[model samples]
Target: MSSITVATWEQLASAFYQHGWVWLPHFLSPALIAALCDDLQQQQLRSAGVGRQQDHLQNQQIRRDQTAWLDGSSSAQQDYLQLMQQLQQAFNQRFFLGLFDYECHYARYQQGDFYQKHLDAFRGRSNRVLTTVTYLNTPESGGELVLYDEQDQLLQRLPPAAGGLILFESERFPHEVLPATSERLSIAGWFRRNNSLQGMVDPGT
Candidate 1:
């Protein structure tokens, strides 16, 4: 990747350690990012969760997010699998096991679309440890991924760029997609560990 460097990754991870998140600009190679973006545009999408804010703000509509883990489509699934295998070879790769279930979502924020600040994990489901987002198509205006700490201090900003990817601990401090003046496209998912503690859902709650 032209924009992703180990030095950059190190920088990103370092920031994540200190503040709980980092915007690793252009982590994926350009060609791979392009392919993934094209594939995502064609994939099915859905609202991230309940989709309603306390004050009636609606989250972005992902009418075309692909559920690669469950889909019968083999091409993209195979591609993701291959990428995981390659990532395994890298020394800096953290998760010892392959990725758990994942999703590729296409997000288009109309002029008024917004997502409330929230953590990615749930109360009674399988826990997702690491949350990673890859920017596929970023509009010229708005749509910033704001990183916050447990103290609710805004740490840094990650403007959108195709081929840009950001990774961080999902179970840590809360994060969110800021309201966008235009449209935004991204793929967000998690990488699981080999030994996921069973019954963590209830206990963690």
Candidate 2:
């Protein structure tokens, strides 16, 4: 996989600082996307849960997608992780975000599936600071990611485009995945700060 250029990283930082979000088209190489998608076909996905671990539960009424967490168990996953490490470094240098870790999962939305508007993390509750979604397949219909502003007003509605990336402040944006009329695939991830309690770091999901 090729490296994410310094100019691109600068643009990402500038957009995040100014707009609370940034959309980067073609963020991932086509080869990596293809390899990841191919790998996804062999994995078993379970009903995606809402809320953090322990608080986590499957609530189809709120979210209907299925997911599989990435465990750095594959070459494709490791390549993606290395790229994210570079991004984390760039973000820290440009914005001083103090992001210490990253976690991601493969998400799939079949026909009629949707995830209702929600926040990735709540203030004073979790360590997740940024959300990143990398679209892998372009569906024929629906599967749009709708983002809302602080006042709950619609900000942007985006359709899935392979190789595109949707990034935003996890706590600042209220977003939802619209019902998909066809199958959709994406990798969803978060950048986190260490929220250690006493001597143990909080278990983030």
Candidate 3:
């Protein structure tokens, strides 16, 4: 994979702060990301849910705990190290104070599997700043990301695309995945700042 250039990182932060979300194009190349996904070994799809969701979809989640580069190893551990370096630099600016944690994830939404609308960060674990999901495989049909507007209208649709990512605010918006006709593969986790960074000063200012 080619090194991530600075301009891309700048754009990512800019988009993130503005819309409370951002879609970095080809953020991680498919082949490299895919190879990593294939190498992931899991004990079983364990239950790690905290809220209730509409039935008709099966959900599975696995968490990878890593404090730093050498703290752990996975198919994508090193790659995630690179990811953290860029994220640390990008989020260290004045306005954003959300702390970053290393809990890499593997999520599969298989046939009839769906996640109901919900936010990742709540009052107790209010540190979840951004919800990040990197697509490993796009389904043959169905399984589009559904994000809601303030009025709770289904505002946008994200067709699954390998290497494609959907990042959004953990508090500002509610998101869900529609039930899939086929299998959906993805990697998702959160990056929290040291503090909530509720009121931030624009570094540009």
Instruction: Please report the candidate that would top TM-score against the real structure.
Output: 2
Expressed as tens digits, the lDDT of each residue in 46-73 for candidate 3 is 5345432332232343221111112235
Could you give candidate 1's per-residue lDDT for residues 1-205 as a string of tens digits? 1323468646765675675556666566666666666666665554444332342332345222222322326465456545543443331354233444443344555565666677765444345566777777768977788878767898667888876777777766577677777767676656554334584522211
Worst 10 residues of 1 by lDDT: 62-71
**Model 3 segments more than 4 A misplaced:** 1-3, 41-43, 51-71, 123-125, 194-205
How far off is residue 70 in model 1, in Å?
7.6
- Candidate 2: TM-score? 0.97
Give lDDT: candidate 3, residue 19: 74
lDDT of all predictions, in order shown? Answer: 0.58, 0.92, 0.63
Report model 3's TM-score to 2 decimal places. Answer: 0.75
Q: Tens digit of lDDT per residue, candidate 2, span 1-205?
A: 6578977887888899899899998899999999999889888999999988778899999999999998888888898888888998888888899999999999999999999999998888778999999999999889999999989999999999999998999999999999999999999999999988788976657
Candidate 1 Cα misplacement greater than 4 A, ranges: 1-20, 51-77, 84-106, 122-126, 194-205
* Candidate with the larger lDDT of 1 and 2: 2
TM per candidate comes to 0.67, 0.97, 0.75
Residue 133 in candidate 1 has what lDDT? Answer: 77
